[model samples]
Target chain A: MKKALSVIMVVVVMFLASFTVVRSASAEEVKITGVITKIEMAADKKSAIAVLKDNKSGESVTITITDDLTLDKFKDHRIVDGDEIRTKFEKEGDKNISKMFKKTAGC
Target chain B: MSGKIITIMLGCALLTTTVQAKEHPGKEQILKDGYQGPKTCEVCHPGKAKEFLGTVHWKHASKADHVDNLNHKEEHGMKNRIYTMCNGNDIVNNLKEIPPNAAGKTKFSGCNTCHPGDHTIDVGSTGPEAEQSIDCLICHSTKYDFRKRKIVKDDKGNVVMTQDRSTEAAANIGRPSIKNCMVCHEAAGGGALVKRGFSMTKEADVHVSKGIICVDCHQAKNHKIPTGRDPNNWASDGIYMTCVGECHSEKPHKDAGINKHTAKIACQTCHIPRTGGAFSKDFTKWEKMSNGFYEPSTLKREVNETAPVYAWYNLTVSNTPHFIGPKGSRTDGKSKIYPFKLFQGKAYYNKKDGQLLSMDFAPPMATGDTLAGVASAAKILGIKDYEPVPGWQTIYFGSNHQVAPKGKALGCANCHSVNGVLNLKELGYSAKEVEKLTTPEIYFEKLLKLQQENE
Candidate 1:
């Protein structure tokens, strides 16, 4: 019984350690500061696409946001066009999925 | 001692302003405590009020650059100029004076509903009060509710436009978006999707589909937005918008024949194929309704994906006595074939002077008394001995928006056949030229040869 309990404890620790590694990998998310040119809300209201003109390069970066927190900000007009934004997104497939979206004008 | 006192006063004023600016709370504080109006914004964006006050949006009039219809020195914009849509006389006649009530509210109706101000001022007026009269949040605040922009009567029985001055709206302030501009522009004929069918919707415009907004092209410089001129539109800042030089190349088409056609055809002539709304005012005739109020008896004409009437336009308007149309012909080298939406209607005119009378029909629509509205308009206009007579009027609006995709452009057979849309003879083409252009076989042979050469 003691040997069996020792094996189970080691297995649980290994699983938690792997989870921590996966969480840290998300730090590879790219950051961009730009002025939002357009924000198109999805018909379902579950997602939105924001086209931002990069402040440095002037190229437009399209980011798809599915997070409810950011979607509520758009719906409530806390975030809007011509606003300077600091965003962090991860490129998944052909889409850039937003992890963080915020206004440079404080909260 | 007086000189020392003056210097001390100036120092205190400067110190006070600096202290206020430094102590100004951030957005978080504004959201929690609620918005405090323009004074709170001025603490950060100084001099913006004065700058905005000088714009045409505030003055409702500006320097005329290309108005050929009226005398430039005498008549300018909304003050003196008239339109087929509504003469705008109601707002002009009822302009509230400067220094509004303690609440900064004024009589708002007609044009004042769209005009941005708490009270009206003189043409060249200035000062702190004038700056305060300017409504910055109307354009800047994303949370600004346009539906709340209603024309209602005050407790004193004076009609006033209600404004959305909610603190919730103030909490979300930013630069004006297309949504702000459309609040007035899209509802020009007093309803949604009515007059001025703007190409801002995804279904109506390719640019919008590609995520293009109005400011991307019509970039407002110092609050002066660049606008294309039209007949009855006199206000101008001398700036113009072009597609080729600004966004597209002069020769955008790959086909040599198609590229050559650009010499005599405007881009909009082919690009914008159709324009109008379900409730677009095609022809309006004010008639007495069963309810006794004078309302428009309209013959609703919708475009509904149809061909637009073609005309040659050289950027000049034919402003004859009681007549207006695009001043261009096929003979003019500088002119190009353009599409226009022809709006026709009946209006009250002076029988003796043969001048079209500007009427404020909004009051009559409610009171059911047509003569009273006319009399009030005439009094404000300083006209003597007016006799109203119904007369026919027409206006040619250029079809400039709702651009179809490039793949849907007019093809060779669309204009080069015998049963083609273009009437060659009516377009000022000579007999021989008409024959040559109408022959589809000859045009196709040439097109085939061009294709073979490319191969």
Candidate 2:
């Protein structure tokens, strides 16, 4: 009975450990500051995808912004092309999914 | 009192002082320079003078024909509307008749309140100075100063504006600058902001900082600036202006939706965005009195957006500069979407029938009495039972100039959101008619989400 209980405890501990690994993978892994190059809205006009030129590498990365965030920004602060923005995002396969959006102080 | 003109004066004064400090040759050298007149200009550049004489600038100063322009009023039957402007003794000898209060108290004039006898190149002359001919330096001078000194009373109460053509003539002659054009054009309706709407304020010239000038797109050939405008909102197939598409070959946006949207919108519609920031300096409010005219009530330097004001436009209106208004619609193959300002006027209706007449003519600042101008217009148009409709002359004006840079352009929500700037019903679109228009691929991700949720 004790042997069986130890195995069950081990299995429970592994399941909890897997959740942390998954959370770590999805947490903000990339930090980049760049000027916005372009923004395109979905056909439903619900969300938008923005392309930003990475200030350090001169490479461009795409970030997905949800519609709620877009509406919030549109109502008050507008993020336009040529505006410098710093974003922390998670790498979701081939895509860079935005976790936070902040308009930075540079060009 | 002269709202837009004051702004023009203020703007020009600042700009002139800056350019002058850097470029002014010196008072002594200017006095020595021999810029006798247009005849002097004609000596070497006769071709230019001949071409210029045929243009509107030459005719803008001449008398009688100026009054005769109001002959349309007589043709329409309002003879009382025929009045003179600037016939003061302070004016030149050739005016043919003196004014009601010649060179005395402030008097009534036609459009000549600000369009007075050639403040541009006449130097200070109250009449056509130099030869009874055109002034070349006003347009051709690189360092032209068009500041007309106020005709103030001397110790002896005399009125004078130097009448010194030599001072302006001797400045420096070259291609005209944006400064030369904006001197008058900037203050069209006595203020920058309806009889004077649809203007490019000094703050709103997008290309000026980039070294672009007026004549670049509004190129002159034979002294005629071919603005390619067509009044009465005709098809835009043949008429052309360089504001967009022509000057910029490709569609400006990266998205296809915006590109497709351009078919029904003008570039200024998006570029100009909203009005009445630094671009608009005054709010003109006229109250309709029992006398069948509008009288000035609340006038303030409020740059906030005035809800309903259309631009006076095209060659059809004498006061406006040359411009092409939006001329096409989606039904027409020639439609290129253009944006416009929605202008409001005091409506005129029949007192008996209570039917609407026209609010075609709104008296500008120079017209002294707003009600009198409206009465004259009503009478001229043969509306005997006409009455003023308070606060209901909503009209549309095509947006021009005042183009904002890309960074400052309107956001998509300005026109695309649930409660956007435009009304879908007014535009002939039902809610369902404008539903999602994407291809099947747009639903691919959403479908996956649905599947995941079901799991």
Best by DockQ: 1
TM-score of chain B of 2: 0.58
Q: Model 1 chain B — which ten-residue stretch has the worst lDDT?
A: B97-106
TM-score of chain B of 1: 0.80
Kindly state the fnat score of candidate 1: 0.03
lDDT of each: 0.64, 0.45
lDDT tens digits, residue span B324-380, model 1: 667778777878888776665566678888777776654555554556656767877
Whole-model alpha-carbon lDDT for candidate 2: 0.45
The residue ranges of model 1 lying beyond 4 angstroms of the native Cα positions read A1-107, B1-36, B90-109, B119-126, B146-162, B165-167, B277-294, B303-306, B442-455
Per-model B-chain TM-score? 0.80, 0.58
Off by over 4 Å in 2: A1-107, B1-33, B58-104, B107-109, B113-131, B142-164, B194-203, B228-240, B245-247, B254-257, B277-329, B347-392, B437-455
Let me know the TM-score candidate 2 reaches against the reference structure.
Answer: 0.49
Candidate 2: Cα lDDT at B413: 52
Docking class of 1: incorrect
Looking at model 1, residue A5 earns an lDDT score of: 98
Poorest stretch of ten by lDDT in candidate 2 chain B: B81-90
